[model samples]
Target chain A: MSDAKLLRDELRKKYLEFGLEAMSDEEVVRLVLSLSCNEFDSFTEKLIEGFGSLKSIEDADPQALVRYSDIGERSAVLFRMVSEISRCLAVKNVKKGVYLRTTADAKSFFAPLFTDHREERLAVVCLSSRLKAVAPASVIAEGAAASVRASCRRITALALDLKADGVIIAHSHPSGKAVPSSGDCASTELLASALSRFGIALIDHIIVAADDCVSLRETDIPLSFRDRECFGYKITKLL
Target chain B: MGKGSIHSGHRDRMRSRFLTLGSGGFSEHEILELLLFYSIPRANTNETAHALIERFGSLENVLAAAPEELMTIKGIKSESAFVIRLMHDLCKRYSATSDVSADLSDDEKLEGFLTEYFSENHGNVCLLLDMTPRGELRSTKCLPTSSLLSGELGSREIAELVVRNGFVRVVIGQCIDGDKCIPDASCYSLTRLFAETLAPLGTELHDHIICCSGKCFSMRKNGSFSFGSGGNHE
Candidate 1:
């Protein structure tokens, strides 16, 4: 018998013996795509049960499916392809121009920020005239009580770059304790000063810790330096 | 043929068949498969192994997932989650307690453990262990710092613990905070101390790891705290 014929016969036998339960995730995909909508629905349900859920089947790695007794390479690849499509479809729905106005909004905004990190990160959230999010919300600097000097510069540059009317500097305490350090205070002061030079307001410096937040603007830390303008040698003016 | 020879021949055949069936082996996947062996008695776990990798995106991601999160999978029960978490525990054991159990020097064991154990904690934590090389009772504390532990851990009081406890090695590990590649200050200081304090004792101060959320980064591996573009270690 020809190779193709032999393969078909073997697959047929396995289908008869194992039912759909034994069919590979790939075969299931092929059958579903080829079938009419009603048939596809039935097959999909069967698949959901066998594989446990849509997420499991959707998230299943193709190579793993091939390890099944009757599954082959083609089946696994097709299964993975379907899941990829689902992911693309899911992400495609989110549009830009969305503004974060609340804690939930901030959480959603920062969700992607912490998705794949391995270190605690600090970012400065700059806001435009409409309080919309401007680009570059982070200033990269490190060390325990490490100076946030670089962060100040980065935040100022972001504010200037985005031409924002005001800015909120934010940093994450990956340790989950959202308390602001003295370094945070110093950095916020520096950033506020730099932003004011461009007529940008430093509205808040928020520290995000594991599960809480600390707003420095709410505290008694010095914010008046932001009002002082040192233009040159003898021109020290408090705006 | 002697009776011993006959028994040996039978054992060899069984071994070959076991190898062919790929039922028992020491491959990384096999180790992962075995992790679920206790929970899944009847089914082959190769597919589950691949499923976990696909679902989570990588092996490290799987290990990094919370046991609660892992139990959300369809086929996974509480027992399975426990088993999976145990693999991480086992790896941690290899790094922190293995040397002592093997009767190696405390300092040597600590160094070896740091290299091996800390690699698995892809998230940042400040671990305060109170145990001797011989598995003696000591104080144990775990402070999850996400990806920063340097400042909280950099105090002289902590340093004093290193000297007093005679810690042969110390690990300052972190979980990558996010796309914020700004290195964590606490992690940096903690690692610096980890290197300095453990070194003089002839104990190897292994790399302080910044676990990028799902995987780990060895400061020693990256050469410095400098993070890559879009890597979020900043």
Candidate 2:
């Protein structure tokens, strides 16, 4: 057998013996790839070279994987499956509990939304009467490289369908600071207003970036529940 | 200030009441005030709550308002605002999963539900299930660590376990391998003994399943064990 096949067999044995955490991300990718496939080693190296990290690789599209590399269609499909499985496993921890009671709970529940990323992704989690997660739906996934703009209308529609009592809107900033930009503040207000019309509370907006999370509600900023009137902050430029 | 002291006094009373009565005791403003304490630490949140309610026209509106509007109020910072938001999100998450009860008559659904507790490292589990008359799962417990992966557990130990739990209609699931759904011939030998033990107690062993990877095999479904009686044990 070729080197990749030999390595894959070894990793499989270790995975069965130890656990999923036994192998690193690239090791996982290397093991999943084919020994018989043509022009894959240099392709992996080049893909990593271009993306700079394993998370970026996982976040990229299979179309991008195929377009950027010299690998076959089947290999790209397999790579996508691996990436999807990794995400599923990451989110599985939060699925055990139906309710979230604290910002820490919200942070833990939404961690999967932030992990393995190269660009921003915005999502809204809808909650029922007891503060339990009803559905966590994606609001905007196909944003620009550095930012994502979530639509208030779409989030309101989803919360209405779930008959949600509350909503948590969140986003990831890839490898940057977790602080909300001025635009983030502006958009959140719009979304919050929209959600309020349906009597669903816009609970909090969380930004996850670089292993840290910033809760806009928990920050020392002027934005808080006690003051809900728009104080003439010239945010039109930012929005 | 006198106003600060009054607000602090009210916040303390609200918090104490909340501990005793749970969230059922608080109004929307009271709930928002309580949640804000986590983020704001030592602030008098009375005026804070009032300001928000006035601007947003209700407790939900205040909690849901944009951070910019929240910022316009004094003492309402990011930290305090986050807690309000958190309370809202927590409500949403709790509602999503609490609506469904875990009872079902379908075998496939039971199997799917049971699979949640199994993973590669944890496949050593053996579940003792108390089943309803309609084959719905009433309760399930893993036979303790002493009888875990060693496979030293016989039907006698399982019989005692079922007796202790007072379970009548039973189903057993043992994972032989982490990823393989196949059962050994030993499953039949053990299940036969289980049926034999339960027959005298007026209870029944309905099924014995071998769970592995993501699939399972049921002895009752395959007709591997005879449902006949044996009741000579003390």
Candidate 3:
């Protein structure tokens, strides 16, 4: 039998016998595409190698789907479309509200923004006194541009401009991990102090890496981390 | 003491705190310091974390930064920078699963699921979501307004698509510009017609949704040609 035929037969058996939940990423993709074993092995290996993992493949640009995997434009477009639709479906299922409820709320709201985004992005959501979003979350920063290194001066200025009573700041990590960096700690403090100067509360500083969002406040991070930093720029900015 | 052994105690202490309180247990700087212990080994992550926060301005910025940019930090080696990137990445990469838990299958959630497609574009969008009788989603097929207008697509056109896609149950949708999602007579008549047409092909019309922006109204929810008796409507 042809390599394609063997793959199709196995997939048919899998679907009939086990279930989709038991299938690996490569198996699912192979079953969907109906590629031969050789094609499947090569495509899966190359795609996984180029992108970080099976889950991470969806994060790659559509062009990468074609260039790296040797899939035709039509298939690449289909892959992109399917992945995008999946993300949309996930976002749609969440409860809709403007209020900053919990870290889970922030996570769902920000997940769509990081979908396959290649460069880092900074999003600032201004909130009313009730913690409801006053306006659509705005992308105040991106890539290597000036905004990426958001100055405390400008960030605070934006809060005042928006007339926001509270603000939640978020950013994407294209690199897949959502762990906060030292810079993330320093900037959140800087921005928090700057926002506080005008009595605008900083509700949270969220880190969106790949698909996960973590609010610094929700994590109950150790307080000692804050003690040492207070002696430096935060005090100067507060003054 | 060896380098790894030196930080081991602090690592265990910090890990214990993280295990107990999650982010509640540590400040943002402590969070970064804890993360750094993995990559830098013997180095003083406390000082490194502080230095990084000082250089990058905040923990959020540091995580969002590219690895190459992170490497520019004085004590951060390539290995540590990559690890930092991973720490930030692990959250989003895992959450991207979009599991659509069992509880989110209500009318509002169902419509909300369809509305996500509309939020990305403004046009007469059409979608066919195939799902099992248990309300588990199978696949979603979309026809953009650029390809075929939702209002313009006839029963035969859409019914043929249903048959071609090999689905027994299908929920259809179209996007409009305005917010008021009151399903018009045309929506009812088209769904009624589609139900009659799809009935012959052994396919069931689950729902027809009219969506605008992030809001959507379901024809099925509003009882537009209820399809209780298989594909054939008496």
- In lDDT terms, which candidate is top? 3
Q: Can you tell me the DockQ of model 2?
A: 0.01
Candidate 3: tens digits of C-alpha lDDT, residues A1-239: 98767767787577447655566666656653442234655566555444423443443334335544676443343244334434433433332346665656665566555443446778777777776777667666667642324656666778799888877778877656778777787777777777777877777777876325576765556523233221111111100
Q: Which residue runs does candidate 3 get wrong by more than 4 Å?
A: A1-97, A146-151, A223-239, B1-234
Off by over 4 Å in 1: A1-50, A58-112, A115-118, A134-148, A225-239, B1-234
DockQ of each: 0.02, 0.01, 0.01
lDDT of each: 0.46, 0.56, 0.58
Chain A alone, TM-score per model: 0.52, 0.58, 0.52
TM-score order, best first, reads: 2, 1, 3
A1-239 per-residue lDDT for model 2 (tens digits): 88755755675566446543565545545544523254455566655554433434443344344545556544554443333333332333245336666677676566555443345677678877577787544434433623323467677777888788877778887647888888888777777777677787777787876436777777667654314432221111100
Ranking by DockQ: 1, 3, 2
lDDT of 1 by residue, A126-148 (tens): 56666576553443443343245
Cα error of candidate 1 at position A40, Å:
18
Tens digits of per-residue lDDT, candidate 3, B1-234, equal 776776777666665454333332345577778766545655678887888888887666777688788888788887677556543443343345433322224577677666664564334535556654435454455443322324444556666556544565667777665668877665666667667777778777777888875777776666655764264332
Per-prediction RMSD in angstroms? 22.0, 23.5, 19.6
Q: Lowest lDDT 10-mer window, candidate 2 chain A?
A: A230-239
Where does model 3 sit among the CAPRI classes?
A: incorrect
